[model samples]
Target: MKHPTSYRTSIIGRTAGRLGVLTAACLTALAVAAPAEASTFSYPGHGVAVVHDRATTHADRAHPDQYRDSFAIHELGAVFGLGADNRATAVSAGCSASHPCRSIALSFQIVTMAGSHVRINATNLGRAVNEQCPGCQTLAGAYQFIVSTPAPFSLDAQARNQLAVIHHRLDALQTSNASIDDIKQRADALAAQVKTILDRAAAAAPKDREVNPLGTTGPSVTMHRHFDGPS
Candidate 1:
């Protein structure tokens, strides 16, 4: 007769080996599944209107009395999608009221998206404003019609404005004569500060809220459907 202890040990070893193999297979399959690609779609009857105005008064002797006002308007129709992590991605084509038919594409991992409160903040500096000359006063403005599914998705304008200001400051610093290292340090610091503020605000805001369902007779697009249509 076989020893009971030996048989138990053999069975245990086999079970362990099977588990290991299964774990490895799972990991391998995930690796081969490919990074999720952003889906592209065209939105019909959707539009976005953005307007910006800026004014600057020179404080320097050479241009002490110089004042300049810049105005821009952006209009577009675009589509938005949610990533696996529930972030927002957008693609649009339209002209600012001032310009015409300029293409716009925005992709950012959303930190939070729920109810009337939708916060989409990104760490990218590309959208920062650039100050061409020093010692010049500057003012800027921007507007956007965020088209998202399920209608009634709203953003915190205050947060968006603060973020824009941060970017503007960073851009202004870049035009300064400060050393590259110094600029980078300052930029990083500013970025950190903005991030901290955003974090705190997010934490303070209420997480749970009532969400308006799709097809509720509000906006044309009511349902927040999958980025890709039903396969």
Candidate 2:
């Protein structure tokens, strides 16, 4: 006696209610099992970070400098130098101009600098590598950088534009195996310098309150990041 559409709708509603109950129960169980101070949420796949390194294509024959710059491709200071100390040893003691350490399978990362105010961590991405350097102190891994700021701040239109430009340059670095020389040349031709752009962006931000606690305004901010990769 009931309409087909109405009967199907009733059945669908009941099924949905059952599914909702099941989902809630599973979540509650997971919450109990999870740690007390678990800081991160499971990624919902909105944004994904990838290591677009050229050296990976020719790992066995890649130069140390080439391998090093691959990681430095990400230019943000907020997300630079993650697993750097480990990477540095290989650069300084591992190889030199005379005794080149060929066949580098060095693991590198760029992480946010630790601060009392901010808790920084990274969501690691699995990028498998064959051990080309035997008995070497190394890690072969990648990461998507994460930062939790002390205070919540919104990006203004100007700030958003500046960030867009920075992202473009970083994308170029990631996609190309361009040498420092070629990069510099292109920048020179275009009259754009990475340091200058970053300095301008930093200047636009408020002065460090801690730097001048007594005064209303702080001193000029000088922010710099240098890549200390092998030559």
Q: Which candidate wins on TM-score? A: 2
Which lDDT values do the candidates have, in the order given? 0.26, 0.27
In model 2, where is the ten-residue run with the lowest total lDDT? 7-16
The alpha-carbon lDDT assigned to residue 156 of candidate 2 equals 44
Candidate 1: tens digits of C-alpha lDDT, residues 1-231? 211110000000000000011133433333233232221111233211111111222222222222121111111212121111111122112212332111111112112222222222111111212123332222221112223223223336776576556655644542355543454455446545555545544444432224533434222211111121001
> Which pairs clash in the backbone of model 2?
82-110, 82-111
The most accurate candidate by lDDT is: 2
lDDT of 2 by residue, 1-231 (tens): 211110000000000001011233433343334331111122122111112221131222233322222233232222111221112112212433443332222222322221122212222332322244332222222222222121112334664465456544533442344543454344233223433433354345443346445444421222222222222
Mind sharing the TM-score for model 1?
0.29
Candidate 1's C-alpha lDDT? 0.26
Residue-level lDDT for 226 in candidate 2:
22
